[model samples]
Target: MSVTAITASTNSSSVRGSANATTNCLRLRRSHILFGTEKRYLSNQCVQNFRFTKPSNECGQRCIRVEAGWLFKGGGEQGSDARLERSESANEDILIFFYQLDLATRVQYALNLEEYDIAKQLRNKLNEVEAEVIKQREMKRGSSSKSEAQDKGISLLRLRADLQNAIENENYSLAAGIRDQISKLEADSLAATIKAQAFEKAEFEFRLGQKVRHKKFGYRAVVCGMDPVCCETSSWMENAHVDQLTRGADQPYYQVLVDVHEDPNLLVAYVPEENLLAPEEPDKAKFDHPYASFLFYGMDSAGDFIPVKQLREKYNRPRHEVPYDPQQDQTGDDNA
Candidate 1:
């Protein structure tokens, strides 16, 4: 036999092995996503353009590795396009597949684990995955008929999605710009609520020490406080930036030490009232915050937070003085 024939045969076997491995990985990833505790969404818009087969149990109830690069959609359903499609979407597929796996397999353990560093790494992975998912959806939207059909008219849905994505990705500069555009589009809505109002208004009624869920920031801690209070002096100001503090003066804000954050000790949020909502269940979730001890002396039988002795006394004492409203500071009042 010729040397070229032997070398070609060897390469063929290696390529077949690699293709099978990729298929198994894809199968495992699909199962993980389908049975996830908190299901991550898979958009039909993503898969609609492509034609693919379901995993077959005929393969010994084991993995059904589809033929090489069969999952990818190439233009026109023809020949060498197979090779080109693999090269094109390989990075995107790997990123998305691993991202789905992270959502399914890593999150529960990440939350349960006590080790700070490992949990943080897991959380950062989750954030990256979530950001990728949002970017993918946004890109899909941009390429759809809807974007083209708009003909320069504003799509508030797209704008809102982009704004939320920017905020979640910590793109503060971009968020600010998007926010300004949204305000302009919804100027009438803002004008309606622009009359006399309190510095902070609770969209949902809840007191301090209650458990609540934030639409963006997830579970635990409801720290209701005076608007624009000086948290820079407290441990609760760990992730608080000037932009976050000054961003939503017209809305109520909750001061919270978010549990299971990258830095549980320092990752506090002044979440806007609009973002706050009741937890899925009424049973209060026990959260451990480093500053909780300083703020609460102990929990009562019903698990309510109790203020420290000296702290409550200082506030309860009568002062023949008007209380300071930090929200007024925006109107050029500095005399706190």
Candidate 2:
């Protein structure tokens, strides 16, 4: 073989090998493109299958994985559909947490309210019990007061009845004793009544004064003096005595001078103080004039008016007739 021919042959063989290698490289690139197109179509088909699965239990898990990958790659479907599903899950979790917290708070509030209501009920019951106790005590006091009043009234009535019986039977000693008892009762009752009245008047601001009516006396007398009279003999005589007088003998007499205001011609009459009233204003017209008049025609042996002292002596004297002497009559006839 020539050198030129061998070199041409080598060059031709190299060109042919290079041409084959280039063809294989083109074939591998075409295969790679086809495989990539197949993968893209499979991914699109998977998405379409997920849309067609109608949210069943089995398909839901697959949908979650596919959508998660798509979101990580930042590609596919604008993410609106998958976002809706994720939002629903998040909302469900939030609702569950809210329910738990709300239930716990409600339980605590209910317990507090129940305790408050129980406390209020107990307070009201205590108030009722206290009021009942006060009412019972008042009732007991009223009953006791009524019984005491009834007993006292019965005793007073019996005492009064006994006093009346003693007075009717002329038992002076018994009557006097009863009178003392009655006086004591009256004083005690008066004192109690006065004390009660004073207490009432203090609260009500009552006035104190004498009250009167004009029909009878037209004036009221206040009890200015309450002096009790002494029962001694000396006090009695000092209060009730007449004048002591001496007669012709050694006998002394007590004469009381009586007053005759309306009649000057009438003399003073004497009486004992026991038989007379303490000299109040008297009716003068009743005593001054006599109801009947007697005129005597006898000679004026005494004056027309007779002193009360001598009237008793003259009234006791008997009438006497003058006797005629016979010797005196004969001597007178001879002289004639």
Instruction: Give the winner by lDDT.
Output: 1
TM-score of each: 0.28, 0.18
TM-score of 2: 0.18
Q: Scored by CA lDDT, what does every candidate get?
A: 0.39, 0.26
Per-residue CA lDDT of candidate 2, range 1-336, in tens? 101000000121111112111100011121011000000112211101001011122422212212211111221242222111111221222222222232233334434556444334334433443354335333322333344445556667888999999989999899899888877776665544443333233221100111111121111111100101111134333332322311111111111111122221111111221222321331222221120011112211211112222112222222322245687679989999
Clashes of 2: 0
- Angstrom error at residue 128, model 2: 15
- Quantify how close model 2 is to the true structure by its C-alpha RMSD in Å: 67.0
* Poorest 10 consecutive residues by lDDT, candidate 1: 1-10
